[model samples]
Target chain A: MIILHHLNNSRSQRILWMLEELELPYEIKRYERDSKTMLAPPSLRQVHPLGKSPIISDGEVTMAESGAIIEYLGQKYGDGRLIPETGSADYRQYIYWMHYAEGSLMPPLLLRLVFEAIKSKPLPFFIKPVARKIADETTRQFIAPQIKTHFDYVEKFLGEHEWMAGHKLTGADIQMSFPLEASVARGVADSYPNITAYVKRFQERPAYQRALQAGGDYDYA
Target chain B: MIILHHLNNSRSQRILWMLEELELPYEIKRYERDSKTMLAPPSLRQVHPLGKSPIISDGEVTMAESGAIIEYLGQKYGDGRLIPETGSADYRQYIYWMHYAEGSLMPPLLLRLVFEAIKSKPLPFFIKPVARKIADETTRQFIAPQIKTHFDYVEKFLGEHEWMAGHKLTGADIQMSFPLEASVARGVADSYPNITAYVKRFQERPAYQRALQAGGDYDYA
Candidate 1:
């Protein structure tokens, strides 16, 4: 059986959802964040060196990185589901989103989170305003605009195609779900109707709902 | 013809390297970053919506994201080169590094660049110290440590395997070349002999050298 070394409130939740979508029999080995630091527990490193969440082990194969895991499982067990036929335009889009989710999209969103934390985290009163200013300026000047550009690009794409890879739901959408969900949850994507509806449409899936149950305490959902 | 919408000092340089590795005929349409802002030229959006570097157009297909472009070329043109066979452990490693390069690795490195910029950028005299403090603390506390963790992880991995995907040099190494090069060029990996050697090993490749000539002004190389 495959074991997802799951971590709370991380990308692993989406992996769980993917497994559910494949209807694969799997087990979840839950790991929680350090409540204070919000970092993945050190024990998680045993699975993969960097200790990032969503590491999965099946027999001798242990993998980290959501895109790799998704592609691995899709190839191994998907049986023509959740994957576009290779060489099609949809396949190209699938590969693009698979990389773009973490490569392009998540970085800015992660920066937004880091900067927001900088704004709110308690600091010496003298330094507080300066820190807030720095965070605000960085967000306003750098992070926010980039995020808007990406969200706008995605919103327009979703408007044209029902799914990230096209009309049919593919692993690209599964790969894309977390970042878009986080966008919706953070209120940054409130104006993006297509994105919000995309999130809602996926969340309403019985498989997604089941994955939520199997996983626990996901704030983004 | 595969026309790489090349951008100076950006990820597209690796796409050029991949093209050379495959010995494919390709054209480079160069875009330079803004001298002051250091962002990709606005005109790149003509090729892809995100306007990010490394967009490529071959006939009807126009694609963005380095991993996608590399995979597309490897599958369509590689003809049993760079990519590993399906279901093999080497293939798994290839996928991991493909995603890990941009997905797992680049974000913190990017944050380091942003914070480093924050430290050095001209600011109001009164606010300079506090801004520096914020940048320093963030780097010391978050960005630097994360980068270290990753570099160390990679160093250990490289110690065990000659290439990212095992004994053979694969597309994973090409996918990984830029950030590792950036790490070395920035002097962070001066102490990481394996990484430095890894970068050096690939840089000396005839294809990589050819790529440098074709794609001008790549700082990381």
Candidate 2:
């Protein structure tokens, strides 16, 4: 049996959906974010030292990091179901998106979030404008363009391939689901039709709906 | 032939090291970062849409993202030399480090860089203190502790294993080499003996030395 250490409203939701898609029997141990800080609770540290979620333990083996866990689950339980065959061209693309999601894509999005928070964070009245200016300038000059570059790249990819890897659904699609969904939920992806539709197409999956029910109150869904 | 789009002082150096380790014939197409902005040159955009470093092309396939490319090179040229056997416990750890290097680790380090720049960035005399304060507070409140948490976790792991995955040098070690080296180069990792020694251990490799010569002027080494 697989035990997923799930954090509400985080990337862990994708793990649940992956489990559902694989039809694997798993139990979800939920952790909530600190309401004020929006950081994962300290209790998660007991599960994995970093305390970030989407960790899974099967028997004696424990794992963290979504891309790794997704690959693990796909290999251990998937029996070659959720991933493309190794050494195929699509397999190459599969590996690319799996790493690209959190590696290449999320950093700028995370930076954008940090700067937006800095822009609005309550400060001494005199310091407010200065802080906003710094945040706005950084966002305009760097963060925003980096994001646009990524989105445009993803949009172009999706325009050609039905899924991230190829014609079939693979773990890369599951791996990519959270970031794409979050972009839509955050209202920044309305203009990218392929991305918006890609999110919708994944959401409409029966397995996705079941995972949503199991995960509970996911913000990005 | 593999052609690496090498970028100065960037993660692409790891790809060069991996190529040398495999003893494969390859070519390097170096792209210098803009001296002022420290961003990859526009020429890179022609290779990968996002214009990121460490992109590689073999035959007709061009791939981006370090972890993905590392996996690709290992699979294509390694003949089972650089990775653990699939589905083993060590292989699981190998995959974990591959993603964790860039996915979990680099973001906080990158954030620290951003905030450090914000603190030192030239600003109006009136606003400098306020911008610095915001940057300082965020570093104190969030980024610093996050980096510490990740480094501490890595330190504990390295204490137990000679290599990142197990006793042998796998692609995971190659994947993790950049961030660990950069942390040392940036002067934040000296306190962690295991990390420092691990960086030294790999740097002493003949393949790594050859990579240094081929790479030309790597800061992290």
DockQ per candidate: 0.88, 0.91
TM-score attained by chain A of model 2: 0.98
Q: For residues B117-169, write the lDDT of model 2, one tens digit per residue.
A: 98788888888888888999999998999999999999998898899887889
Q: What are the per-residue Cα lDDT tens digits for candidate 2 across A1-221? A: 89999999998999999999999899989899999989899999998899999899999999999999999999988887888999999899999999999998899999999999888888888888888889999999989998999999999988988998878789999989878899999998999999999999999999999999998998887
lDDT by residue for model 1 (B84-169), tens: 99889899999999999999889998888888899898999999998888888889998888999999999988878789996877
In candidate 2, which residue ranges exceed 4 Å CA deviation? Answer: none
Give the C-alpha lDDT of model 1: 0.91
Docking class of 2: high
CA lDDT scores, all candidates in order: 0.91, 0.91
Model 1 ranges with Cα > 4 A deviation: none
- In model 2, how large is the Cα lDDT of residue A95? 99
